[model samples]
Target chain A: MSSYNWAPGFIDDGDRAQIVTSRFQYEDGHTLDRYLATGGYAGLKAALARTPTQVHEEVKAATLLGRGGAGFPAGTKWGLCPEGKWPRYLVVNGDESEPGTYKDRLLMERDPHQLIEGCLITCYAVGLSQCFLYVRGEMALAQERVAAALNEAYAAGYIGRNILGSKFSVDIVLHWGAGAYVVGEETALIESLEGNRGMPRLKPPFFPAAIGLYGKPTIVNNVETLANLPWLLTHSAAEYMAIGTPTSPGTRMIAVSGHVRRPGVFEIINGTTTFRDLLYGDEFCQGIRDDNELKAFVPGGGSAPWFLPDQLDLPFEAKLVGAAGSMLGSGAVMVMDETTDIPVAALTLARFYAHESCGKCVPCREGATWLERIMERLVDGHGTENDLDQLLEIGQTICPGPFPHAASERLGLAAVPFPFKMTTICFVGPSAYTPVHSAVTLFRSEFEARIVKRKLIPVSIGASDE
Target chain B: MTRLNDANQVLAREIIGRYPKARSATIPLLHVAQQQNGYITQEAIAHIAELVGATSAEVLGTCTFYEMFKMHPVGKYLINICTTMSCALMGAEQLVTHAEQRLGIKAGGTTPDGLFTLERVECQAACTEAPCLQANYRYRYRVNAAQLDQFLDDLAEGQLDAEIPAHGVVARVRQSIPVDRAVSVVAPDDVHEAPVWMPLSGTTA
Candidate 1:
């Protein structure tokens, strides 16, 4: 929507990945006419001609997964809604508030029509008549572009009232979330869409696909995941599946930020690209900025644990990264060079989780705030060994794992049951401790170096008060 | 001035009709109300409550949850500086420290003259353009101390006024749905009131 003179993006790296960002390769692709000229809504036309089940089967065959943090299969998610539910809704998760993730922002602003067309395909396939695009509030330019494109679509009969001579009449409402990271969660997004405070609802009773958006069956997909629809529809599922691994097929957008020579979103074939290639290879980041040695990198977004330089040669796939005790979450590679202060970095990421924690669950709400406080003290050089112990203790209490004490020693603490099942309602609980825990574990010396024990004023041990 | 004016009320109603439930319009109406006044006021919240069929406390609760919906007045130009990981790695902290020195106020403080307020934000989603800042929510990429000075000078002399608006007015290009495509006009009794900003049909281009 605005003029720009950024670098020639990572799309130039053709051999590494099929360039899914071809629409964005040109500046004019954001407009409806330009997008149509580039064969954009042709997918929707082809999709509408087929039966809804056929449309569902094609998507299922391709196995395109959600680009949001969950990485759930987009096709399987569509099948979750039970049939015969009238007024079924489609929600486009454009709330890309992940710390190092900016791929959706680029997609929304650079080529919005592809995303809208993707939404139309999903709406038709799912037999849903209404869609709500919950865009982040700060994305003003993206909203403007999408709004202008919607006006064009409305005029061309692409959106609203019987589409392309078909009986299906679909409408999409562009809604805005003020600014809450928790709303990225489907149920919290539903809560935000309902004109209430965005809070993550407890699952099982509130699994969004089965019952969501005012207790109706809803399908939620990320912007980037939906943007891939036109390409998949135009090409055969076999062609799409040939791009990446058998499991995590197709190209994925990776927002490579932090200490990179050319920091921007780079699309890569899943399970092929490694963290080292992303941060150092010519096609991607072109090496860390100032030619410094890469010390550590967040393989995913802020929630991901830091990957040390020695361990970064592993492929960028969910299974491999998960095997390495991290995740390919949101595919945001945030790098930090040798000069970075480990304690400060931990505190910064910890603060984000704490600030965004919606105060809904005790583990996330209390745990995040508590971790942020301890991390701050560590960064400020007033940390004690006890503070480190306290952080681990609190983190476990929020989402307890193996009992820290002996079975015999745990006799009295049985009342303090822990969720050990990943803590709170949302991932915010474990995410809050991700950076803090990782830093304490991987860089113990760094934490110990920052310690400057504060002397407490001597006090009589509870004198006669008891 | 705090209440949605005669014209904006129609726009509010049109937005309300877009959703099955009228209460869903609360967020958009809050934006329109904020634009009318610099920030949301008690009267505007009350007006929005009545329009959306929600309680004042409920509206306030929703408003408070979002960081963008300002409850108090802000400076004419809000300078949101990104100090997150990506930007920090590229020297955003130094820029912030330099900005504090230049402005004679720390981040989140408005100048005494109230022209600009500098805020250290998490990220503005412009990580590629490290050390970026948003003036009145418009992007300023790859900024340094020199750029900050020039921006302030331009702002002080009303040079950047054409590009950047006052705090509350979010978008310079208004959203004007065509008359024929206006969802509000579908029902006469339900939402007959026409929005003032709706451009005549076929003229949006």
Candidate 2:
């Protein structure tokens, strides 16, 4: 979307079924004229023709899952809004600050009208009057484009009062965040929307659908999640459901980063596409960079645990990935080459969580910082075998129980599947420990070697010349 | 150091009017305050508090929670080189080291000339272009050592002045929604009945 020189395979190929990124290749793609010329607001028009309840039913039938990390079905989330709550709101989460994730930023920047159209359809279906488009602050282009698009849509009568003579009227407001990753969480997003510190409220009593922005019923959706509505409404639910695997239908945009020959964002088949296809397929990354063998890869975003080469053939399904002890969160697959130092990589991720921990919960704030400190000491060659145990112990304090990890089987620890038990308020606590757990358990020898050296180890991860 | 001037105050008032509650404009108003000053000042915080009907302490509380809202002043050109895992895996650390030596300042330090400020940041979501950096939140991708030097040289020479703005200037365009254009701004307490589509209580689906 930033016109980076990297060529994604799907962009050139005509065979691929790209729903969200169909208009990405064209110049002036973000403009309303291009959007209208290329069948942009047809979904909203079609949605306006049907009853709001009927539109809701159609999306429910499609079973569209939230693409912003958690795989919660969007339709199910919409129904959770109280039946009689008036002036309900729809909040679109564009706060895509995850380490390996950049697809949502592209969605907001390249095809903002598609997202706006999606928001219109969603607000119409869910009986909501106002929608907030909360984008991350760092994305200057995305904010400008979306704000410009909103002005266009308002002028064109696509947004605002009584759209095209339909009785439904909606107001779409664009709000941007100052810089926080934990705000990506729904409740935290709601809090930030209310001009408070971006902290996750305790659930049950504080669900967004029940008590949301300004203490009214609200539906917070991701940019991609709402972006799917345009396509899903344009076609039948059955037709939408037929593209990918039954459970995980529709194409997913995966931002493949780290050591790869052709690293870029690719829209692959949802559940059927495997890590092998993504990392090595000719239509995808082509292969690892510089003919290097793959060492490990982060299946989801930075929060996901590391996956070994043996699990490369597993499908990109949520349930399947979760069964393997990591969730395909945020669709950010980071490929690590054989040259990668596992401890250093883990520390990098640990420091990210430490810096991002909002300090709302003690475990995430204190435990994550301590984890980074220990990992930093270990990577700097001043650690001992005891420090490795201390890392796990600190991780245990965040996520309770015999934590199931990437190397749990080899470590003789119980390999219980994910939805890992947590002691903190949100997943940010466990996310800090994910890297430490996966790296230490899977590559204990590397960490041990660093500890034994007792001297600063020269990092030789990647060559810039390549 | 001064409060929002007449021009910025008009922009600030327009922003506060968009939200149903004035408190929701705190973040956006802070952005305006930052853009007016290089960084958010105590005077700007007090002005935003008066504008948004929140106390200065409350406004400061919200501003401090976010990383982007700098409490102290930064250099004219703030260079945030992302050294997180994905970026680090692609030689982001080496780039940071290169920048530190070249700029003669560590990650969180600004140059003595006050032209450049360097900081090791987390993910900026440009992972595919590994080892990316943001100069005033405008992205520079796949930066090698030479390109970094060229960028710095270009910045110092004012060659890239038109392309990139100062630290707090995120976007030049401000979002404006006219009063007539707004669908409805009825407060939550005033609304009682659900939409025609939503079934009322004790009614079948």
Candidate 3:
């Protein structure tokens, strides 16, 4: 099989038998034996050797960021917990349900031992005795694989009391979430884990590090993020950091789907590869299968804003994407070719966000539904000038605005800041606005043509929607 | 026959205990019921409703919301086709047609031999390998009409008798065939009885 240079040292060996990990090279089926062979439980063993403070410092030095949406540094979050807190829980957010995102599913299903190893390391780092792997409910097979791996760890003395004859002890629990897009959010995940409707809670007082699952100190890390812990512990942080960009180190699993010749998940070093490299440089994604021109791309799943083809040169890093007014949200790159109608595609995504909105926030609930309805009307050729304005208005409403002037004034405070200023405030509402704004700005002519012609002019699927 | 095996009862109680209000356990209870019994019969749903203190309609509403919960009887092997945009674009229709033709049944219909049940579903997030299907919860991605044929053949001939490979994006046949033939066997007690169809409210059709 042909191998691609995904990064400086990492290569897509295309080996079906070997499991992909930073330190270990285990054959596919012998996960338990091979994992043990490669000093897999060494991190847990090392963590068990030290105090929780030492473990926390080691992780903090590694600077591992959560591989889920919002790449917050994992160690920093863990260090923020109050001392002497009992029952600190580590939640493995395995709810990999993001559209165009399938990397976590592959990791959880293929090399579950790696994830369990990482979870154990994390539990020891935070002085937590119990950890929960909160997988999406639909992933029955993945859940079973994880459960089997956990059982294997328990049987092999990698988990449970005095793991590896050390003083540390931890137990892993598997919790499946009712399928919902909102449940992927940290607060919403906590709610769902608590067996409540998966609605996101307001921040400030309820941050997961302070008060989380069962109202105790909790840290929720993504599957892929936790999967990196064992490797980080086994190898020096500098060795791992040598692979990727300074800001975003290590390999990121990029899931490329939609209108590609070969669509699958591949792990690429954070800044070494570009969109074109993933999409066009290989026989796998042989550049728009049907000779269609590329229109636009969702750099990160359906939630992230659309990026014009020109922006493909931008580094595939979260910080860089955020600088470009888009997010590397979940690393779900959805490529849309020319044949796709921008209005129709936008309407479809809008409809999804609207349907999945938990109805807890007024702006997101009402605004997203209105945007979907209006965009649907516009796409179907029933758009009026008023409808276009209404669509824009709804998009603005969903974009977190400052509190109303009257409310701010009544509170005797300075002018209220825009909702976008609060980094952790509401990512969903702003995320919902990205595609809408992009569709309007980049495809103004298309929208205008649809309105004037009152019909869709089909373009090549690979042609630019703009 | 086992009067709710220990595992099933434990699963039921465990799911119910997760919720603060016992009434919130209706949906998961119905799922457990369906998993225990091949399909959620009216009696099973009623029993769940009584257990969770929910009306039948309320329980039914929860059941109908998720596509996984089966309201009616399915064949021994359930084949769920992906009908979402990504799969549709990759000729999921052809795969569905091929399945129907090979199985001699429609998309939502079961085989006359009561061996296979095919249904259309929304996106399975395996769009990278578009045109995928889930047979008994194991994903079969990058599927075409011919691959489906090979899979059906392997399944029919009982050649597939290993644990399904848990990961990757390749097109391969996966099987978790039950070890005990007695446990895996789906015996038809009688054939003369009318084909029982549950209300479509809880089903994708």
Candidate 4:
């Protein structure tokens, strides 16, 4: 079979350093032997040779950040863990649940050891006795592969007591999450790990570092962030720093889906490429599928805001993309062509938010359902002139407004839930409104076109007057 | 009310052993229990609570939150057709309509014969392969009407048992962690059977 360019972890044009996805080049690359041949465990061995502080120093020098949606510095987060705390845990987030994002799935399936080595390095740095790898419930293949890899690592004496003849030893337990999107949140994940509903915990005393799994200090890093450790440790920190921008260092895996000629995953240097290049480059997606003109695209996953073709020139960095009115969250770009229906797309996202709401908070629970209903009515040709404005108002109430005030507010009416901002205990509430808000602003005509002419309402006493 | 077999019980113990605290193993044990019974029943809930060192109420709290863990008895094959953006763009709604027509059931209904349970789910992370559905969570992508009909035919004949087992069976590969490398397989001493399914008040955190 010809080697397909549309392969996960397949970089079109780049050096073959192969940090997170090094094993994609070989057959059965997940096996210990295959990974070892590619200099995989050398980083862990080097980390073993040095003190944990030095490992932290190297990672800090690289300025590595979390690859999960939130881009916090990973090394500093590790530093925040209180020193000499017994049973301090390291949790690697393998729960790749964001819509249109699947890079972590590939990393877990194709090269389990990369993640394993990363875990080993992290556990050593943070002085943790164990690390929990939580995989999503639906990823059966990823779970199986990771389980087998953990078994192999245990058998080889890389895990358990006195690992690799070093004083450091970290036990790994793999947990499978039943289908819940909120579990991807670190605190919620900890709750799910404790056999509770995966509801997000409040901050300012509930941070994972201060209070985490089993009521102990825990360092929770994304799979991609941890996977970068083996490479940065083996290579010099300066070398790793040179790969990407100063703000967002190192190459990131971008999963390009939806209306692309060759939809797949590719690792690109951060901030070096634009959406246009990623979408149209021959070595990349080879242009949009069916030669359809691009209408709009989701800069990140479905939860992130949308961007029109004019914004395609924005660089692929989190802060830059955020400045451009979108986010590179999860690095999954979903391209929508001219034939796409913006209202229907907005409805799909709204429905997802509504269904996934944990029903804990008020604004999220009520506002999500209201937004979904309004969008549904808009798409079904039953919307009125005020319905579109009503969706914006309700979305603002759910998300809390600072930017892009609802049309009703512009019309000088009383703002529903005025001066609201991040009221919910978690980000899920704000997320429920993001897509609807973005769609209404970018494609107002689409929402308005679905509205039918307003009819007069009849009063009970004056019914015969018609 | 069926309980896990002796072999599955042993497997469950090993999984429980992996966790430092036994209560953390609740989800894994639930998966095993669901694999034993087509869905989690009272008996399986009690047994899982016993294994994971938690209350039956606590167990139910966890189980009810996740969508994948079935609370009621479902058909043998769980047909989940993803109707999200990617699939919807490729006409997944039509596929859902067609599947519902062919099965003579709605999106969330199970057939009269107890063979197929149809569900119109969100994305299954196979967006690249548009218009995809899963037969018992095993993906079948780029599916048209003809392929769906063929799949239904195969299901009717009971020909896909080797590839796709009946509902609730988690994985074909049995979980057997070797004895020596297994960490802390000993169950906690204070473990007891759940008294009842009473959801306690206060401190849900």
Question: Highest DockQ among the candidates is held by which one?
Answer: 2
Instruction: Give lDDT tens digits, candidate 3, residues A418-458.
Output: 22432234566665555666677667668877774445576
Which parts of model 4 are misplaced by more than 4 Å? A1-17, A404-420, A457-466, B174-179, B182-205
TM-score of chain A of each: 0.91, 0.94, 0.86, 0.92
Candidate 2 lDDT for residue A445: 92
Ranking by DockQ: 2, 1, 4, 3
TM-score of each: 0.91, 0.95, 0.76, 0.91
- Tens-digit lDDT track of model 4 for A1-466: 1123222334445452446766676657789888878896899999888767678889988989788887788888877765434446788888777777878877887788899999998887666666888988887777778888888888888776667766665578888888888788888899899888999887866469877887777889898998899998888789988877788778888878788888767877786778888899876788888998988888788777777776777788776676556667787888888888888877887888889889888989999899999889889998889987897788666654553222222233221221236777776777778778878877788888878887799557755755
Of the pair 2 and 4, which is ahead by lDDT? 2
* C-alpha lDDT (0 to 100) for residue A3 of candidate 3: 17
Best by lDDT: 2
Residues B1-205 of candidate 1 have per-residue lDDT tens digits of 7789999999898788787787788988898888888889999999999999999999999999998888888888888888777787778889999989998999989899988788888767777777788886788888888998998899989987777778877654434445554333232123322122212220111
Quote the lDDT for A74 in model 2. Answer: 88
- For candidate 2, write residues A1-466 as lDDT tens digits: 3243422222334267778888888757899999999998999989988877788889889989999888888888888887666778899999998889988888887899999999999888888878999999988888988999999989888888878877778889999899999999999999898898899998666468888888888998999989989999899899889989889999899989999998878888899999998889887788999999999999999999888886788898988877777889999999999999899999999999999999988989999999999999899988887898999999989988866555344455544478878888888999999999999888889988887644667777777655
Worst 10 residues of 2 chain B by lDDT: B196-205
Task: Give the fraction of native contacts in model 2.
Answer: 0.69
After superposition, which runs of candidate 2 have C-alpha atoms over 4 Å from their true positions?
A1-14, A407-415, A453-466, B196-205
Native-to-model Cα distance after best TM-score fit, residue A79 in candidate 1, in Å? 0.3
Worst 10 residues of 3 chain B by lDDT: B178-187
Which scores greater on lDDT, model 1 or model 3?
1
Better of 2 and 4 by TM-score: 2
Give the CAPRI rating of model 4. Answer: acceptable
